[model samples]
Target chain A: MSEKPYVSVENISKWYPYKGDKLINHEKKFIKANDDINLSIQKGEILGVIGESGCGKSTLGKLLTRLETPTAGDCLINGVSTKELIKNDMKAFRRSVQIIFQNPFDTFTPRDTIEQILLRPLKNHNIGNSKEERRKLCIERLEEGGLVPGEDIMKRYPHELSGGQLQRISIIRAMLLDPEFIVADEPVSMLDVSVRAEIINMLLDLAKLHNTAVMFISHDIALTRYISDNIAVMYLGKVVEYGKADEVVNNPGHPYTKALISNCASIDPDDEREEISITGEPPTPLDPGPGCYFAPRCFMACEKCLKEYPDKKNLSDTHWITCMNAE
Target chain B: MKNNRLTIAAQAVKSNRQLMAGCIGVLALLVLMIAAPLISTEDPTIYGPDVLNGLGENGHILGTNHLGQDVYSMIIYGVRTSVKVAVISAMISGILGVLIGGAAGFLGGKVDVIISEIINVFMMLPTFFLILLIVALFGNSLTNVMIVIGITTWPGNAKLMRAQALSLRERVFVKSAEAMGETKRQILFKYIIPNGIFPVIANTTLGMANAILTEAGLSFLGLGDPSIISWGQMIYAGKQYITSAWWICAFSGIAIIIAVLIFYMLGDGLNKVMDPRYNKRRA
Candidate 1:
């Protein structure tokens, strides 16, 4: 890890008002999308966030990118608070950070051709002086993104291109501004298995080329482990475990993290490992009871685990787990 | 690129007989309107000594009205009036509705609520009567009539545009644009409007048809500008003399019907051609 973090998420929490039921209005309810998240990424480091579908992994990405303001605390980029930077200079903040969404099909405007989509960020940020220069830059970026003979694909609309092709274009769009920090929210989850590795490798290569810090968010733990330098395992809007990717994956400290890792299909033919399957589904985020959010579904739950939320226990200098019995 | 759209439109028009017929009728009327002055032997509004001249008599091909103005020339000039009013009112209303409603839908939140409330208020009132009252109070000038019609008829289009904008605003591309640090104006015009404009274009064609019909109705009620001679005005001028000079009312009424029908067909054709759902099925 670098001496100074490129991106810092400091106890940030995002709570959305729950308005599902109209009759019961006495107590204001909120869906705690992201609760007290604290993580950082060094320059050129990939921090993978692995979780279930509604674990607020995407929400944390949104917060880090400044797409959504945190309800409490703040996220800092290069030591400057995102909220303050956004208020002070939104364009500068935007140019500094970019996001790659999961759905490549939905990322580009239907009206815009691939060229137009790529040129938008360059034009907005005034990357190139002239239109020709911008066009050249776009073609160059497309080539770098593994699209050879870029001119052929330039005129094609989003619908004309395959999902994998569009995903490449999206990556090029994010890298267009030469953004320092990138929040890739399940960037390859929507892609086919055949093209997934290619896209991932391309993303990693591009991030390395730019020396860009990245937050790789995904539900696929194995995929996240392959690309990430460090990993944070989240459950019900809280990070249950945080450590080096290989360390955490090999020796998961938290019960939730252990179950999550075990759930991923292993590759070895002869290795037989019993999967740890938790029974009950994760509770709704709205008005979570006074306990660890995972306590309801945890196999190793006890009186203390069900009564109070656990604090972060340092298993090592770098590895931190938020379960009472993890240590 | 524009040629591609044109080709698609041509293909769509060729495939549909009603659209083809509508195009022919509209084109023929447009040609007549353009050639009105060159084609007419005498001024349409000029009064002559020979009043209520029958068809094909004394150089009056379609006969003269009660005031002895040639009905053929009047009908030709009436096309100009009706087309002008329809085009102007449609342009004004279409632009106004798209701007207000597109902004409301794209911006959403409080702006949507406020604009939606205004649209609701406009929709709740009897639009025709409100237009009549405004025109009466503002004085029945041609410009005033066009403006009133344009302003009064936007609520429906606005509501439609708002609905389009609302759905488009939720599109992932729109969110991506925002994430790219695009300004609201850029997102609205460059992204939202372009994608959401098809329905508005279809709505505008329909609105033009409505505007032409509304103008005719207003003119028939004697609220049209007297300086201008429209099909409705010609009908109003010849209504009392229906028993004596039947051609005066007959020809003008037929012209009005044909114009309205042509516009309706064009609007319907445009709706079918422009609808994305239809295009997807065709693809």
Candidate 2:
């Protein structure tokens, strides 16, 4: 890895205006979708982000891809802030970063054929010299996406293809630009279980061959562990735990991370272990009171946890936990 | 081989008996209009010696009016005039509506509010009276009538296109295009317009029918160009001699009714066939 991270997210936060009851004269509210998130990824690194729905995992992906602007802080690409890069060189910024959406079927224009969909990004970024050259490049990228005989699929429309086929085409479309960083937001969660492994493998292989950094967001802990070098666990729009993948999974420091690991479904029949299930939902993001957001649901909740939010406590050179009790 | 658009349209027309009937009627009328010179014995405006002649008199199949002009020939040629005016006017209005509505719906926010308010203002006023006022003030020439009718009839279609564009703007594919760094023009024309255009196309046929009716109404009210021989003008000319020449008014009225009905049926069939929801249901 190089001395400088390829993409760095520095204390970024995103909030949305929340409309309260019209009948009441209450103050305007805001939902803290992402709260002071900090992370970075080097070249050829895959950082897995695991969180339940509404935990701001997708919001973070949007922030990194510049699909949505951060309400506070900034994300740096190669040491330059994204806002500056966008203002100065928007086309370059777009070419450098791409996103793979969750729902493959909805990602493509229904009127466009597979060839048109794949050729668009290359054409937009002016990647190839001529139309004929771009056509060849598209075919090669589709093959890299594991879709054999790309020419046959090119003539077909989105409705004609299966979910898995469309998804592979989407991945190929993102890769056609030769982007530096990609944010795959639950890319395979919408596909069938049988096809999920194939897609994941193809994605990882492509990322490796391209030497591209990726932020793979998913709710599946086992899958994240298999593909990611490092994992960040999020709860209620906050990163409750951050560390190496195996360390976070095997030696979970935060209580929420431990509960998440135990919650992972196992197939072993003879193994007997006590499952730690957190009760009650995470508090609503609207105007959440001070202190730990997870204190209400944490089994080890204490007076200090309810009174003040815990700061990051480093356990090792690479592992960090945000819980005071964990130290 | 996969079915192309033309083949699918042909199949759609063939499958529905009412649509087939409507197509056949409109096709026959169109042929008659095109072959009017060959089929007519004499120019419709040329006066003859036989005045107020009954049907089949002096070889005039539909008889002669008070001016001794052949009513059958007049009706045949009037088809050409009516179609020309309706088509031109509908095209003008359709283009204008789609442009305004598509821009409003896709751009949204303040643009939407402004355009929508303008459309509402137009919609609230009586459209027919507005057309009449414009034509009356501009002098009722054929071109003036067509332009006035075209301009007055666009607000409704604009509202429809705007609604479609609004929904289409939110589709995931549009966002995907934006994320790919596509320009605003590319997204609007390539993605938004093509997807939201079916309703506009379907509405255009209805607009043509409405334009035909409006033109006929104007001609009946003596607001039509004096030089043109339209079905409405025929009825207006024959009304003074109604007791003696009922065929003149009745036949022209029938022609107008048939033309408008054919367009309405075409619009209805197009709405069903072109609708994606309908296609999904069939699939």
Candidate 3:
């Protein structure tokens, strides 16, 4: 609250036109992927975003990277509006903000060797003087990402490597720009359980080393709590809970965040956490009327919760929940 | 300097002399193919007492082969056969490749699996030998050679288009382009086809040249249509008198080389014209 944020998202709503609905219709239906989303990250801080599939976590990541523009509002990086930056200084904006995609395999072009992929960003960004210097940088970055024998891996194609290796390479590629902010959109979701920690730790350490603000998105709340300074839990298209990771995990205010936390598999043998069961699937994003999106699935849903949507209710100076019914 | 690349490229093509040679050579060959009868009234099939005539002896222009058939008339006439086979077969293969490979790649799932398997199978078979086998079985008529070459050579183009289409559809720009309201056909033609078709196109020129060479090989082996006096047939008819009438094979071989080389140059020039990278200005 005291320090000015390095990266701040200001009520950016990304509502995709519902493909099943006709675009020519006067009242075009929308799948609100991220609606009035607000969050901020300090320099070198990791903001973990935990949400289930189709909960707009990836959409939020895309918005952060300016891959898909928001339908309304803007994201600010170092106080420069990303939306306006697109027209005026898009190349610089791209250099400052990078995204690590979920699918490591698809992120890379198959035809290009790993070295070419590493060198391209440098070439486009004009990082090195000559091809040789750029290539050496590529090798150094690859080794830093824990891919040993960088020279060997650089010459090989994406198909030649493991998913974990490719994911590491993807991180290395993103961080190669020495970005001001990065969105690691489920960087380890597709990876094996053993290597997930390695990748996450690598990202965290690198972000800290570069003083890079990061939006670490994943469905695993426990893991998010482990890596993030702040955690924002998304449901449908809205952030249901935003707080310190420990604050949210220890005392989840929103029914959805509690539900998400309850579903996590604990490592402790004596763990006796109660699983809070809620009813019904998420209603279609196309016509999510006046009520809260989680109201139908919320265990604590009441008549008021069904009839009206709620706004953020402060828990502490830095913690808040969107549910009005929370104690 | 900041002008549209395409407009500049159009101007560049107009001014490029190498491209001009290719176009002029192609144009001259087309004229030869179309105006063979008008240019020379002498029947290329007819043999006379003007045997083994060397380079304009006894009123024959290039010379006569073992049959005393005027090599000049025969070569001018051979343009029709050589160019026709190449053009027609190249079209057939290109069309076949785009359709099959495009469907397989764009459709995906069962269609891709089946079509890709077929492509792999086709790739395994040596294309030239396959064409030879088919021509041998079905009888080596001009039409048959053209059709066989067309069918056998298409798999390479199909494989390329398939790989390109598969990869292109997944590209970030292409996906965003599709999302921004371009119709499938428009995207296919504009984004997909243009990107992928270059490899297919590059393959096509080689295909045409190979077709010419294959036809020559077939004729040398006495498998071509006996009625037409093609360059290959001319070569065949002159092989027996190699020492005395070296001009017969030499001239026919040279004509073949010129034809093949022109096709290559034409293809290379056209490739340059279409490629966006060619718009770069020299210092």
Candidate 4:
């Protein structure tokens, strides 16, 4: 990891108010999708975000990619606040950051051929001299993404391609733009297990080649740990723990994090340990209280943990946890 | 199961009796409009040798009006008038509706609310009466009537286009385009409009039929352009002669009904073909 961060998320929060019922009688309740998130990634560094479903991992990715702006606070990319960026600069900002959506089928326009899809970003950004030049460039990019004989693929529509191949094309599009940052929100989760690694490896290769800052969001801790230098575990909408991938994996801090890692079954039958299960779903995000969100499900929930949000207690120079009763 | 879109659409149109009937009617009228001068070189406004000549007398196919005008020539010119009003007025309304509704749908926020409110206000207004008031206020030339009907009757199209735009704007492809650094206007024009245009087209076909009906209604009230001939004007002129020369109003009324029916069928055909679930279930 570099000493300087390329992207710094500073105390960001995203709250969505309940529709048609706001301020009618009682206090206006807002769903805290992301509550005061703070993390950073250096150029060429991958930050893996692991969380249960609807724990704000995808929301974090969206916020990083500026798909949805932070309701409060700002993200700094090379000393420039994302919130402060103006109208003309938004296009450039968008060009710099790209997101790979989870659903491969929905990523590409069904109406557009692969060539049209590939050439669209290029044409929008004025990357080519002419239509013929853009077409050639598209074919080149497709081949580079390992869809060999890209010429044949150009005529095929999106539905004609497999999930894995479509994902590679999406990655190719991101690479074609040469974005500075990327948010792969469960990029491989929707694909067959056999092709997941191939897709992830393609993304990893692209990030390494372009030196792009990547925030890989997924529910699989091991996958994120394998691909990311640093990993942040989220519970509900709060980041419960963040540290080096090895440290988090070897010395899991938050109780929620410990249960999460231990739950991933292994190949060896002899490799056995007592399971620390936090059963059932997390609490609703509507009007979240002023305590740790994980406290309700935490195995080591102290009385203090129920009433107060914990500060980030440093476990090491490179590791931290947001639990007051962390072991 | 493996048919491409164009072939599927063609098959759908072919099988749909409503759409085929409408297409034939509209196409026949279009053909007649194109061949207007060749169909009858004789001036529509010119008086014939005899007044109130019945059908087949002196080579008059539909006979002559009380003014000694060739009923056949007047009907030809009336087709020209009705077709022109329908086409031009529908075009104008469709364009306006697409633009306004598309902008409102894609740019949702204050702009959306404002545009939607405007649409609502326009929707609430009685369009026929609105047209009537405008025509009554402004002198009723063919151009004036066409423009008035075009401008007033756009709210239906706008509402439809707005609904389509609302759905299309949320599509992943649209978001992908937005993330590609395309400007709001560019996305609105290139992506949202094109995808959402099918519904607008189906609705506007129906609107074309309505435009003809509206024009006929205007002319039937004796508010038609004095210089040109129309089916409604022919009907009005034939009203007093109903006891004797019933051919005058009857034939023009029939023309008006035929023109309106065909366009309605065409529009209905388009709707069925465009319905995503319709053919998918068939296959």
TM-scores vs. true structure, each candidate: 0.96, 0.94, 0.64, 0.95
Deviation of model 2 at B116, angstroms: 1.5
- Model 4 lDDT per residue over B92-114, tens place: 99999999989888888998899
* Candidate 4 local lDDT, A130-196, one digit each (tens): 9999999888878888898899999899999999999999888888888999989899999999999
Candidate 1: tens digits of C-alpha lDDT, residues B1-283: 6787699778999876777877898898889988989987889878987799998999889999878798988888889999999889988999999899999998888988999999999889898999899988989988988998889888888988888889988777887888899999998899878888777777787787788888888988999999998988888889999998899999988988888888788888878876667668877
Candidate 1 residue spans exceeding 4 A from truth: B15-17, B38-41, B276-283
User: Residue B140 in candidate 3 has what lDDT?
Assistant: 81
**Model 1 TM-score, all chains together:** 0.96
- Over 4 Å off, model 4: A20-24, A86-88, B1-5, B40-43, B280-283
Task: Give the per-residue lDDT digits (tens) of candidate 2, residues B29-144.
Answer: 78988899998877998999989999999999999999899999999999998998888998888888988999999998899999999999988989889888998888999999
Winner by DockQ between candidate 4 and candidate 3? 4
The sequence of per-residue lDDT tens digits that candidate 3 reaches over residues A1-327 is: 789998899999999777664546767678888899999999999899988889899888888877677999888887989877866865577778888878887766554578866776677678899999999988988887889999999988788899999988888877777888888888888889999889888988898899998999988877889999999999888998999999999898888888878878889868888998777777777768588888877788888887888988999998999996988
Error of 2 at B4 (Å): 3.9
Candidate order by DockQ, decreasing, is: 1, 2, 4, 3
| i-RMS for every candidate | 1.0, 1.2, 7.3, 1.4
In order, candidate lDDTs are: 0.88, 0.88, 0.82, 0.86
In candidate 1, position B11 carries an lDDT of 94
Window of ten residues with lowest summed lDDT in model 1 chain A: A19-28
lDDT of 3 at B158: 92
